[model samples]
Target: MLIPYGTYNDDIRADIRAFGELLDKQAEAEAWIKQFDEKAASAREKIKTAVKDGETVGIYELRSQEFYVLGDNWGRGGQVIYNALKLTPPPAVKEVVDANTPPKLISQEVLPQFAADHMFVTTYETKQEDKDKFFGNAVYKNLPAVKNNHIYEMTFEQMYYYDPLAIEGQLDLVVEQLLAHQAK
Candidate 1:
C-alpha cells in the first residue's frame, strides 16, 4: 500500500513509526510557534466578526480529497485567510504530525465527517474536465460544501505556494470566492 505524498489511503497500513530524537526536538520549535499563535488567534477573531459567526472554511485538495487545516502548532501562508477570517478549521486531531505536511486524506468511498460553509477545491491541473471529475466524484459530490453549492474551484497556482506574495494571492482569492458565495 503505497500512499503518495499529499494523499493518504485508508486501506494502507498506517505509518505510525517513531521519529525518535527529531520528534523530541520539536518542543523547542513549538515554543517559538506559541509566540505567534496569539497574533493568528486575534486575526481569526476579527475575521469571524466580519463573516457569519461560526461558519467553517476548509480547503479540500481535489487531487486527493484531503482537507487542509492549520496543521501542527504553527500558522503558514496558506492558512492566512482561515486565520484572518477566523473560520473554524477542522477540529484538531491529537497525533504526531509534521509541520507543512499534506492534508488528512479521506477515502473516496466514505463521506467526510467534517463539512465547511465554503469549500475551496484546489488542484495542480488546469483543465476543467479534470476538476469536474474530481468534484463530480461520489463522495465529493455528497460533501456539505458541494451539496450546498458553496464549492469553489481554485487552481493549484492560487493555493499551493507559501511565500509572501502567494499568501496574499490566496487571501485575495478566498475573500473573492467567499464573497461571491455569500452573494449567491
Candidate 2:
C-alpha cells in the first residue's frame, strides 16, 4: 500500500488497515488502530488542557531567507499536521496555511507578522552556520517570540512522518515545550 504524503488522520488509519489486509492481520491491525486513536485523543485532551487559548504556531524548515511551513519534504503541511495532533493554529497562522498548500514558502520578513507567537525550527540537514546567521538577522531578532524566547526545535527525521506514533511523540514535545515556555 502506497500512502501519499498529504494524508490526514483517518487516511493514515485506513492505510494501516490496508496494510493489515495485505498481511492478513485484520484483527491485529484493528487493535493497533484502536491504540492509535486512543493515543491521539489523549494527546488532544492534554493539549487542550495545557493551552487554554489557541496560539499562532509556525513550523518551519528554514533555508536561506525562505522557509517552508511544516517540513522541507512536504510530507505533512497545512492542516494535516495540526489535525493529526488535534491542535489548531490561530487565525493569524491558519489563514496563511489554509490559503497556501503544504510546504508553503514563507519569507522571513512576512512570517513574523503572521505567526510570531510560537515557532518550531527544523534542523535536519541544515547547517548550524546558516541557522546562526538567520538568528542574527534583524527580522528574526525582532520577532516577539524571539524576544520572549518562545522558539523551539524539531527534527525533520521525526516530524516529517506525521504518523500516529510520530504525533504521539510530537504532542509530548509540544506540551513540554509550551509548558516550559509558559513557566518562563
Candidate 3:
C-alpha cells in the first residue's frame, strides 16, 4: 500500500494492542491503548487531516501476512502510502500467517512467496553488502519484487525501537526515499 508521510498515532496504537494480543500480553496491550487514546484525544483534528490527505501508507504486523497501518517508520514507503489512504477511509484488515500459525524457516524458496508490491524496510552492515546479500543470489532473483527493484534498505539503528515521535520522524525520511524512488 502507498501512504503519505505523516504520523498515524491511532493506527500505531492499534498495532501495539494487536501485538500484545498476539503475544497474549494483555497488560502491555492495555498500556499501549491507554497511551494511544490519550495522545489521540489531544490531536484528533490533526489525525483527521492526515486521514484525508491521501498519503501513501503501508501497514503490516510482525510475522503476519496482514498489513495494519501506514504511518511511522516501522516499515518503508508502504507505510506512507497507507497513511495517505487512511486519510480518506480505513481499509479492511486481513489476517496473514503469523507466528502462532506455524514456524517455517525463511529461505530462498520461501522468500518469493513473501514478495509484495512495495518492499519492506530491512538493513545490513552496509548498502553494498545488503545488495550483495539480497540481490546477488540466484534464489532471490526469482522473486518478482526483487526483479522490480522494490526493496529498501536502512541502517539497523534507524529501524530500532524508539518513542512514537522519534519513530514518526524516521518515517518522514522513509517517505522521502519512497518519493525519490517514484521519481526515478
Candidate 4:
C-alpha cells in the first residue's frame, strides 16, 4: 500500500469531500456538478498530456513495480517518473528504492535490477564524505552499477531539503543525467 509520509491539511480533505458530494446524482445540483467533473477531468488530462511531452516532473517516491501510480503529495520521485512515462518519446525512468527499506539497508542494494542502469544517489552533507569514501573504495568497484559507472551522486539539500518550489530544478538535473547516461 502507498502511504503518505507528510502532512495532510483539513482544508484539502474538505475540498475532496465537497467534490465527492457533487458526484451524487440525488443532489439537486447534479447537472452542474457533472459539468464540473467533466471540466476537471479534462484539465487533468491536459496535465497528463503536457507530461507526455517530456516535461520534468517531481514527486516524493514510487512503489517497487508500479511506476505509474503515485502517492498523493509525498511521492516526489513518483510524480517525475509518471510524467516521464506520459511523454511522447518517454524518457528512461529508474525505479526509486526507499533508502530505509530493510533489503536496501542490509545489502546497500537498489532493486528491480533495471534501476541500476541509471542510478542517482542523493545524501545529506554530513554523510556525503562517508558515502563518497565508501563508493570510491575497491569493494564498491565490483558492484554492477559502480563497475559500469552508472551511479551518479547529488546533494540531498539540492534534491530534497530545499523549498518545495525547487523540486523542478532538481528534476531537471536528474533528467539531464539520466538522458546522458541511459545507454551506457
Candidate 5:
C-alpha cells in the first residue's frame, strides 16, 4: 500500500495487517477505500465549517519545480492543525489521497487560481531562503496572504512527524502563528 509519508505506530501496523488480509478480496479492499474517501470528505466539511467561522489557512510545500498543497487527506501535522482550527485548505486541491502519498504538484500556470488568507510554507532547507524566494516572486505578490505579510515558514520534518511529542510541538507552533497573524 502506498502512503504519502511515514507515520510509525501500531495504527499503521494494523492497517498493514488489514491490507494483507484484504489483498485477495477486491471487493473488501474497494469498500475500505470508499470508507477512507467518506472520512476524508467528512473531514473537509468540518474544516470548511471551521474556516467559515474561524481562521483561514493555506498549507503549502515548496519544491524546486512545483507548488504543492497540503489537503485534508495527507495525514500530516499541518492537516491536523488545519482540522483542529477548522481552517479550510485550498479548494483547488480536490484529490483525496492516502496519508502516505505525496500531494499532487500544481503547475505554475495555475498559480493565480489558488488563494488563501494565510499561508504556511513547508521549508525543507534554508527557511529564510524559501520564504525569500516566495516573497520575491512577482507572480505571488498579489496574493492576499503575501500582500498582507501573512506567509509563514515551517519544516515538514518538524511538523509531519506522527509522534505524540512531535504533534504537540507542531500544534503549538501552528496555533501560535495563527494567533499572531489573526491579531494583526
Candidate 6:
C-alpha cells in the first residue's frame, strides 16, 4: 500500500503512478510529503514532552479479550503507535508472546496479573456480545489494567491501519490516554 523511499524516493513515483498529475508537479508532491514529515515531527516532540522519557508504558492490545497480546514485531497499527510513542511493553507481558525472534504468532494467555497500565481493545462488529462476555469474566476483571478501569474501547475500522492518517488518529486517542494515565 506504500512505496519505500529507499529506491530513489519511491513514494513520489507511487503517487505519480496512481495520480498521473503528480508527475508534472513532482516538486509540489515532494513538498506535500515534507509537510506530513513536519507535522509528524511536531507530534513526536509533543508526545515526548507529555509522556516523559524512559516511561516504559505497560500497553495491552488485542482484537478481542481472548488473551492474545500483540508485540512490536507484529507490524499492526498498535505496533505503529507503540513505535511512534517510543514505548516498550513491560517484561511481565513480553514473556507471553510466541517464542520467536520478531514473532509472527503473537498470541498467549493473559496473566491475571497482566501487567499493563492501559488496554486498547479493537474487535469485530458482530463480536460485541462475545467481547462483553469475555471481559466480564472474573479473570479479566482482575487484570491490573481492567481494575484500574484503563480499558479503552475502539473500533476495528478506526484502527487496523498503518498509513499516516490512521497513525495520527490512533495517536490522538492512545497518547491522550497515556497522558491521562500518567496523571493518575
Worst 10 residues of 4 by lDDT: 97-106
Who wins the lDDT comparison?
2
Worst 10 residues of 3 by lDDT: 93-102
The segments of candidate 1 whose C-alpha lies over 4 angstroms from its true place after superposition are 1-51, 64-77, 92-100, 125-130
Tens-digit lDDT string for candidate 1 (78-157)? 34544434455544322212234556565555436555666666664346676566667887777777777677777766
Models 1 onward score TM values of 0.57, 0.74, 0.45, 0.42, 0.60, 0.58
lDDT at position 10, candidate 5? 29
* Whole-model lDDT per candidate: 0.50, 0.62, 0.42, 0.37, 0.57, 0.52
Ranking by lDDT: 2, 5, 6, 1, 3, 4
Off by over 4 Å in 2: 1-11, 71-81, 90-100, 162-164
Scanning candidate 5 in windows of ten residues, the lowest lDDT window is 7-16
Root-mean-square deviation of every model? 9.3, 3.6, 11.2, 10.6, 8.0, 6.0
**Predicted candidate 3 versus true structure: per-residue lDDT over 1-184, tens digit per residue:** 3434323333555556655766899797787657645543444343343222432222222222211222333343322333322222122211122111221234445544444444444443344555465556787566554465544554445654444444455555555554455555
Against the true structure, whose TM-score is highest?
A: 2
Better of 1 and 4 by TM-score: 1
Candidate 1 weakest ten by summed lDDT: 9-18
Positional deviation of residue 12's Cα in model 5 after best superposition, in angstroms: 10
Query: Where's the lowest-lDDT run of ten residues in candidate 6?
Result: 5-14
Q: Write the per-residue lDDT of candidate 2 for residues 1-184, one digit (tens) a residue.
A: 5756544333566767777888999998899878867776776666564445655566777765456665222443322345556455656556555654556676767766555467777755557787888778888888877887778766667666645566556656666776787677
Model 5 over residues 1-184: C-alpha lDDT tens digits? 6643443332322343455465765566556545544554555554442234544566677766457776643535554444434455555543322242466666655665655667777755445666577657888787777777677777677766654345446656766665566566
Alpha-carbon error at 65 in model 5, in Å?
Answer: 3.4
Per-residue error at 90 for model 1, in Å?
A: 2.8
Displacement of the residue 17 alpha carbon in candidate 2, Å: 2.6
lDDT of predicted model 5: 0.57
